[model samples]
Structure formats: C-alpha cells, structure tokens
Target: MSRLYASLFYQKQVTEIFSDRSLLIYMTVVEVALAKAQASVGVIPQEAAQSIETICTAQIVEQLDMEALVMASEQAGNIAIAFVKQLTAIVKASDEKASRYVHWGATSQDILDTACILQCRDALDIIEAQLGNVHQTVLAQAQTHRNLIMIGRTWLQQALPITFGHKLARWASVCKRDLARIGQMKPRVLSVQLGGAVGSLASLGNHGSAVVSAFSRQLNLTAPVCTWHGERDRIVEMASVLALIVGNLGKMARDWSLMMQTEIGELQEPAGNGRGGSSTMPHKRNPVAAASVLAAASRVPVLMASLYQGMVQEHERSLGGWQAEWLSLPEIFQLCSGALERTLNVLDGMRVSPEMMQRNLECTHGLVMAEAVMMALAPKLGRLNAHHLVEDACKRAIKEQRHLKALIGEIEEVRQQFTATQLDDIFRPASYIGNIQEQIDAVLRQAVGAAD
Candidate 1:
C-alpha cells in the first residue's frame, strides 16, 4: 500500500479490517462456494473440497501478487480479468482437474459484491464498538456534571442557563439514536450476493436456491432475496448511515474545539505529556486531538457523494458504477470508523473547566440572568410585557456597562414588582436549568434499557 493509504484508518493497525480479515473472509467464502458447487454438479470429487480449502488457507497474496494483478486489470481495461488469470495459475499448480471448478459459474460481480459486503460488515462492527465507548464516556460525564450550571447560547449570544450535564446528555442521545439506526440496517446491508452473470443464476441450473443457501451458510452471511446486481439501494443506505454518524460526531468535535479556544477556554482536549507543539511560541498548547477529530469529520460528505453517485448503476451489470463503488465505499467506511474512534478518545480524556465555564457566564456582567428575571416576572406581568422589560434592562446593562442587578434596581417597574430579596432567588443561574436531572436520567434509561 502507498504511504497515504497506509496512514488512513482503514489501512492502519487499530482497525485494518477492510484490508485484512475482511478480504481473507471474502475470498475464502467465494472459493469454498465454488468447491461446494463443483461437488453438487459431480464435476469434482467431494474429497477435492479439502484440497481447495487447503489452497485457500495459503496466503492469497503469496500465491498471487494482488497489487500487480489489480494494476494489470486497470491497464487491460477489464474487471477481475487479472484475478482470473492469477487464480487459474494457482489452481493449475494445485490440481488440474479440480482447478476448472474453482470459479465455476461465477462472474466478476459475484466475488466482488460479496467481498464488499463482508468489508462493510467488518467496518460496521468496529464503528459500533467505538460508538459504544463514546456513549459510555458521555454518560459518565453527564452524571459527573448533572448539576453543574453554565450559560446557554443561542445565535451566538447568551439566552439562558443550562447544565453541562444537559449538553453531554444531548450528545449521548444523538449517538444512541444512530446506534439504533445501524442495528436496524445491518441485516439488510450485509446480505450476500451469489447470482451469476446477468443476475439470473441460469448457469447454476435447478439447484440455484440450494447453492445460494449453502454458500451463505458457509460464509455466515445473509443471502439476498434476489440478485441485486444493479440494485444499489442497500449500498446507498449503508453509506448514508455512515455519513450521518460522521456528521453527528463532527458536531460534537466542532463544539468542543470552539470551546477550547484561548478566549473561550471552557473545555480542553485531553493533554498528554508530549501532546502539542509550540515550535515558535513557547507558551502554546494546541488542541491537536480536537483538530484531528474535526478533520476526520469534515471528510465524510465527499466520500458519501461517491456512494450517492454509485446509486445510479447503469444496467443489469453496471461496470462503471459498480467499479466506482468498489473504490469509494470502503474508503467511506474507513474514514467514518476512524473519526468515530478518535472522537471517543477525545471524550474519554476531555477536561472540563467548571471555573472557566462560570467565568464565561459572568463575562457580560450577569446579563445572561435576564431570562431568569423575565420568567420570574412572567406570571405577574404577562410574558410579552416581561420580555420587553427584560429587553430594555439588557440594553441598558450593555450600554452603561452595569450589572443586570443594578439595572433592575434602577427600573421602577422592576422594584414595584419584586423586592431585593426576591431578586436574589431569580438571579440564581442554577434555578433556570429546569429538569436537567430528569432529562439525563431519561437518556441513561434509554441506553441501559436498550442494552438489556
């Protein structure tokens, strides 16, 4: 593999799934199916199955140079033509009579499509496991800060008070929903394909259904209801799901990265002993982990477009569209899995600055508590009238650079409606975060219930 490809998540040690185990399982399934098919047709002795199995166990790359073969196919303007040549050589060396039955009745699409599905399954497992890790981390954070109060912003301005627990709970809920979506789609998306050329299976004769069943059983995959040679809905669905997962994780990363800014240091990515660089500036601690998650998250849409375009397969066998997907789908899965896993790492070691959060809330000198005053007076003055009153107080607080409490004391309407003692109760930031505990509990309940 090229250095660039090797550096990617799909190609690395952490989850080198698509390139290694997935490919091996796919080829093994295809070769075994061919052997079983030959036995059914009486073309090869049943004992020959062991020989075919043995050959498959030998390293596929050792027997045939896949890199050269793939490149040769591109040079020749053919699909699997090079693979056929290489497999023929391997079989010729093994046993001539049994060799003819190696890829009997199978077309390029059969092997390629099944292999892609296996890759998808492997990627899904890795992504799900990483998401589960993220879910647990978020849950723990939510529990830790269930009562910790902070300002909530809307349209880039403070609107009300909220708990850090509420923020973490919202993230957990999004991931929980996506995890459910993945579970719902896995069975349909990972189903196998065994139809021969033209998707009719006509070459397999009357035992077509039995052959497909046996083939699926051996591969530990679900056989499709019918040949989906040109039906690209499942591929599109799976890729879209992956894109959604990345987008959600991106939202989380974006928020955390922004909060880690020097001016608004309410949070920080986990800092290690040798975490970040300050090549020119001595007092710099860059948010490299947060930046990495952000970069990974940003790449999802373009990868997803490849799958979207592949949805428009040309005909019964779309050579161009299917070939495009063969390259794009695995890359999409790779990027998503990488992003998800890294995002988990970020959340697991994330540091919360409660003092910083409180300081940011006070940056505007208690202007954020205006909403509490509005709600407190709503029952007495009516919501619309109280809103306008609070609006005036907020403008004065900003212009005169005065605290909201001072502005309220200056307003005659505010003094007439409430006493200084009453003002203290309304100004409490923690009071405005209504039902945060309830919501956090609800999310934990859902995640735990689903797990059970």
Candidate 2:
C-alpha cells in the first residue's frame, strides 16, 4: 500500500509487529526457557537453557510459513501453541537435547505474556527515540520562529496575537511532557512476566525468584515483584501512557491541518519530489502527512480501551480478558508506533508560512486587535463604557466592510478615548502579544528540568 493510504486509515500493524521475525525468535526463546528452566530447576539441565537460547537466536523468519502458523494458532486457540509447535520442529531438527527442553512445564499464558512484553518493550524503544527526535525538531522550529507574530485563536476564532515561535514552543512543551511520561513508565512497561501456571510460580519453588531474576537479567528487562497472572495494571498503565502520546500527536496534527487550509494558509508540510497527491486537482496539495498522523492517533484510544477492559481480569487468569490483550496490546503498540513515526515526519518536513501568517493576521479584518484596543481604552473610558464604544465601532466597521481604523476614526467616542497615533499602537499585533516569548521560555525550561 502507498504511504498515504497506510498513514491515513489502512495499516497492517499486526503484520508489522510479527513480521520482524527476529523479535519473534527472541521472544520464543525467552518465554520457552523461562518456563523450562523454572520448572525442573536442577533436573531440567542447565544445558537446556543454553541450547534453547542458542537455537532461539538462530531461528529465522524467512524459513517459516507465517500464514500457516497464524491459521494453526487460530485452530489451537492461541498463537503460543503454534509458535511452540514450529519452534519444537526447528530445534528437534538440529539438537535433540534442546528439542526436549523446549516449552517444558508451561501453560500457554506463560509463553504468551512474556512474548508480548518483549514485543511491547521493543516497540517502546522505537517510540521513545522517535519522540525525542520530534521534541528536538519542534524546539528548533520554536526557536527559529520565535519572533514571527500571528493571531492566537480560541474556539476557532481569534482571541489574541501570538508569535509563531510561541505556538511551536507550546508544541515542543507538550511533546516533552509526553517524553517524560514515557520515561516514568519504562520500568513498569519493560517489566518481565514470568508468572507460571497459577501466577505464584508454585511450580518453580524457591528457584522461581532466582530464575526470574536471571531471565530478566538475560533479557535486560525489569523483573516484576511477583507474578501478575491476574494483575494487569502494568499493561493498563502502558496503554494509558501510549494513548496520552497519541492525544498529543493528534492535537499537533489537527492544528497543523487546520493551519494548512486554503483559507488559513498559515502553515504547510513540505511538498517533496514524487510526493503523491490527486492527479486531477493539480492545485490541490492536501496535508496527507498530517492526516496520517491524525488517523493513526484516532484509533489508539479504542485499542487501549480494550486493554483497560483486560485490567478486570478474573481469578488467576481470565481467558476472556487475557485473550482480548492478545489482540489489543500489540495493536496499541503498533498503532502508537505508527503515529509517532508519521508525526516525526510531519515535524521534520513541516513548512512555516510566516508571510501567510502575517497576511492572515489581517484576515479577521483587525478584529483580533479588539482586545488590545479595549485594554488601551479601558482606563480612559471606564471598562464597561469602553467595551460598549469598541463594540459599536466594530459592528459598524463589519457592516460597512471598512477597516477598524476608518470606523474608529469616525467614532466620536473612540476619538475622544484615544488619538489616531495611540490607536495605531493598539492595533499593532506584534505589540499586542503579551510576554509570549517569556511564556515559551518558561515552558521550555520546565520541560528540560523535568526531562533531566
């Protein structure tokens, strides 16, 4: 599929997650030995872990029948079963000792949960790095455009004047906060899941903890305090965090998409060579990149809600809830990862139309400066009286289709409140942006401190 189609609405995230094959191989080895080594302890033979470990590292995706595996997983009622069946064949073909050790003393949950964690962790690494790059790119734009003044809107209408840099700074600040949230969640998100049959690791006895520590250490994962067979707070927390990131990216994409509208024309994503668009509408260059980010972000919350439901797992395990996770967790990770990747592209290639911004500042027919004029005239005319006078003059200007300057020049009350010279200062959008740069700086410093 084209990049546009994938980013917008059609994406095969499930395929992306398992298609790596290398990650799958690692997951199979880790989950299998984690159960095997914990089960027989001194009797299972340490060589089993070694052999299983070596074979896992050697397993190749190119040699396997993925479609068949997926279909068999459905028949077996789980993916882990299919994975073990295939892996057992591979190991048996090479080493009988390793083949005997494969998937020993483990239920399907043990392998599935650990494998999911490992996959989720890999996705997180990619997301964290991408978020960092996005943050820096937005910060650079914020600094570069710090003085480009434009109108600030609330509720789709102009509220006040603000610099383009200030807006970019806000974007950077939101992204930085997301980065911090992800950092706070890493330890928990990366925690190892070694819960055996009933989650108490009752099958492993005293060596359960040692084996867990070893398993986590070998995989560079954080070992959970106890089995979480029935506790899904960690997964829920991860889903929530990812959704938060999605929300941030969505807001950014939505705003940029709005700014790129023909009527607005204040911003644009770079039009690169071979960039795809409508063939018939030669003049139309849609914000496809931004649209992709927004589309990916929009699906994240629904996927995460399923994970939230999974948090209500019953007893030692809820096949119902846990089964939901098998579909939901990977979907969440893949959706979020796709959104982050698209968002980074948007930030990296976004084009700022400072000239257009200045032009659009006048698009509102100087109404955006109404607040500034009111403030300037408030002390002179009394607050309520000043509001009434400016309100009347603004209405007249709109009706007559004339500039506020011309209408105010003819208004006796406005003339009495302020001179033409003073009115010019009041109408200056740049002069009206109050301490915007300072606010930006403060937000940046706070983000940096929190990140540090």
Candidate 3:
C-alpha cells in the first residue's frame, strides 16, 4: 500500500487485516495450528506441538527481519519458504526437539494458502458488516421516498415519471443480491488448503486426512473434499464476487454523480468540512465519494481478471500464476472494502431534494408525460393513431417552445377524445407512477424478510 493514496482508496480496518505484519501473524497462526493438529492426530509429539505453539508468539514474529525475509523470497519464489525458515529457527531457540517438527508433513503453499484464507475470513467479516450497514441505509431511503415523484431518465433523457423510492428500491435489490452472493461464496472460498508438496499429503503417511480435519477444526475453517493447491477456482470465485460488488457500487455512484450535476441537482453527496471540495473552484462540491467508488470499480475488474488468468497453473502448483494472487487478491479485498465504506458514508449523510426533483420533472415542459397522454387517448383514437398524434404533438411542443399539454390540447382529435380536466390529470407526475408503491413494497418485503 502507498502512503500517498492509501487513505483515499483503502479502509483502515481492512488495510490492517491485509498488512505484512498481519500476514506474518496469520502465517504464524497456521504454523501453530498445524503443529497442534499434527499432535492431535498422533503425527507429532504433543510436547513438541506445545513448544512450537508457545514459542511462535506475535512478539517472536515481530522480531524477525522482514526486509531480509522479503529479499530472500526473491530467490525462494514465495515468502512462505523464507517465513518457514525463520519460524523454524524461532521454535528451535526455545526447544531443539520441537524445532524438528516446525513444519513437518507440510509444504510452503499449505502455510501460505491457509494463512491467506484466515485473512480473507477476517476481511470478509468486515465487508459483510459494512454491506449490512449500506443495505439498511438504502432500505431507509427507499421507504422514506416511496411516494416522492421524479422523472425517470432513459439514455440520459427524461422518459417517464417514477418515485425516487423506486430508484432506491432498485439499488436495494442489487445490494440484497450481493449480500446473498457473499453468503453463498463463503462456504466454498473459506475452506482449508492443506495439500503437502504435491496435491497429496504423502509426507504424512497415514495421518494426512486426519491432520487436515483436525487442522480445519483448529482454525475453525471448512475441510474441503480434496486439496485445492492447483485448483484456483475458489480464490477466483472470491475475486469475481468482489468485482461484482464494486460494479454494483459503481452503478450507484454513477447515478448519484449524474444526479448531483448542477443542471440536475436532485441529489448531493454528504457535505462536511473539506469534504467534496475543489482546490480552485470555491463553489464546487464534487461527488468525491462517488468518484472514489467509481475509480475502485474501474480497477477491481482488471485485478479480478488477473486472478482468473492465474487459474491456469502447471499441474499441482503454479509457477508464476499462484504468486500473482499474492498481491491481486489483497488489493481486491482492500478496494472492495473501501468502496463499501464510501457508499455507506454517502448514504448516511446524503441530501435528497424532492423540490429539485419536482422542478426537473417540469423542465421538459410536460413532454415526459407524453406516454400517459398517449395511453389515455389510445382507448378513443386507437393505439397506432394515438401514438402518431402524440408523437407529432411532442415534436411541435419542442419546436414551438410550448408545453406538451398545451400542444396536445390544441389537437382537434385529442380535444374530441378528452376534456381539459382529464388532460390535466394525465400530465400530473404522480398520476403516471403506476404501481410504484407496490413495487417498492415488494422490494422492501424481500429485504425485511432477509433480515429475519
């Protein structure tokens, strides 16, 4: 992580979870857990396991020369190799007999992969909690604005009337699905990776399977049906899910930033001291949170792709492909966490302008209601004739700089079909938002049921 942009793009808790020191600690945890599991399965002396566990403390891990370990990893191909050496030495210093089994019957990839899985479990917990917060905020916004009328845009142009609640409910539905995806993925992705040297734990003799089960129990992780040393699908699946989450956040950010435009001031990101400000433009309150989220969204897909590419390993373990995930996966988690935090911040303090939404709805001079007008006249003029007549009135309204209601009223055929009061009702934004409350309620029911 860079000191320059880390604060801007990384969440603190997640960053700490993926930090080098934290990684070292997690690796130590795997080493300790492995010893205990081996001892439990009668593969190692319980006294030796106790020695390894007691010696491999956070203090011992912190005392190691990280720079030297990292430099040694340059030739070792991965940090796990160098890390195991230091860990062995630390255990040896306390008890010579115990040091013999520091990493007995295990490979470097086992320690590294299991440690990374532990890290992911912690990181995902934070992400899930933050997502729950964002989802709750979205639900609250949807409920509050369920009846607030606004013009729905299509291809960047006003199309028809809709409630702001309807827009928020759509966002809420995606969040619900994202939450579900995370839940479903955890079981598969959070399993233990315990294959030795090759895919089989050949070094452990008859104790491999038993050791794996005990190790999983020790770490509170799932014992997979088979080793995944070469199978990178679980890791890639996690990266893909993280990318999906950021993509959803990006969509929401794009909409919010567009809505915050000066010409369309229907929404604003949360304002605070020095928040969303421009250095030169004193009048600017940019959508900084949305911009950050969009930036993360843009970057996560490529990182996830690299993980996907890394799936093609040479047999049991990869050469360069497995190492590729050493950085990419952490960055994905970091960026995904940052995006979630930014979204929650925006939702927490965001300002919604029903008045501005109402004003913008009329900016088109009632052209947005043409569909309603057409439908109303369809019963009398026939669907095709009504569509043609309303289409003509819309063009005339734009060309003559007149309200569509006025232009439609002047149409001899339209006047013959509908009275002024009926036409007035057709132009009301609220009148055209059909079943919006029901739609919003349906989404809310799903959300509320999920909470239960």
> For residues 164-266, could you state the per-residue lDDT of candidate 1 as single tens digits?
8999999999989889889999888887787888888887787677777777776778878898989988888988888888888888887888778898888
TM-score per model over all chains: 0.93, 0.89, 0.98
Cα displacement (angstroms), candidate 1, residue 209, comes to 1.4
Alpha-carbon shift of residue 286 in model 3 (angstroms): 0.9
Off by over 4 Å in 1: 1-15, 20-25, 37-45, 76-79, 450-452
Query: Model 2's lDDT to the true fold?
Result: 0.76
**Best candidate according to lDDT:** 3
**By the TM-score metric, which is better: model 1 or model 3?**
3
> What is the lDDT, from 0 to 100, of the residue 361 in candidate 1?
82
Worst lDDT run of 10 residues, candidate 1, spans 6-15
| Minimal lDDT window, size 10, model 3 | 443-452
Superior by lDDT: candidate 1 or candidate 3: 3
Arranged by lDDT, best first: 3, 1, 2
Across 311-398, the per-residue lDDT of candidate 3 in tens digits comes to 9889888898999999899999999999999999998889999899989999999999999999998998899999999999999999
lDDT of each: 0.77, 0.76, 0.91
The most accurate candidate by TM-score is: 3
Model 1 quality (TM-score): 0.93
Superposed by TM-score, candidate 3 places the C-alpha of residue 132 at a distance from the truth, in angstroms, of 0.5
- Candidate 2 residue runs with Cα over 4 Å from true position: 1-17, 20-23, 32-43, 60-68, 89-98, 274-276, 411-417, 450-452
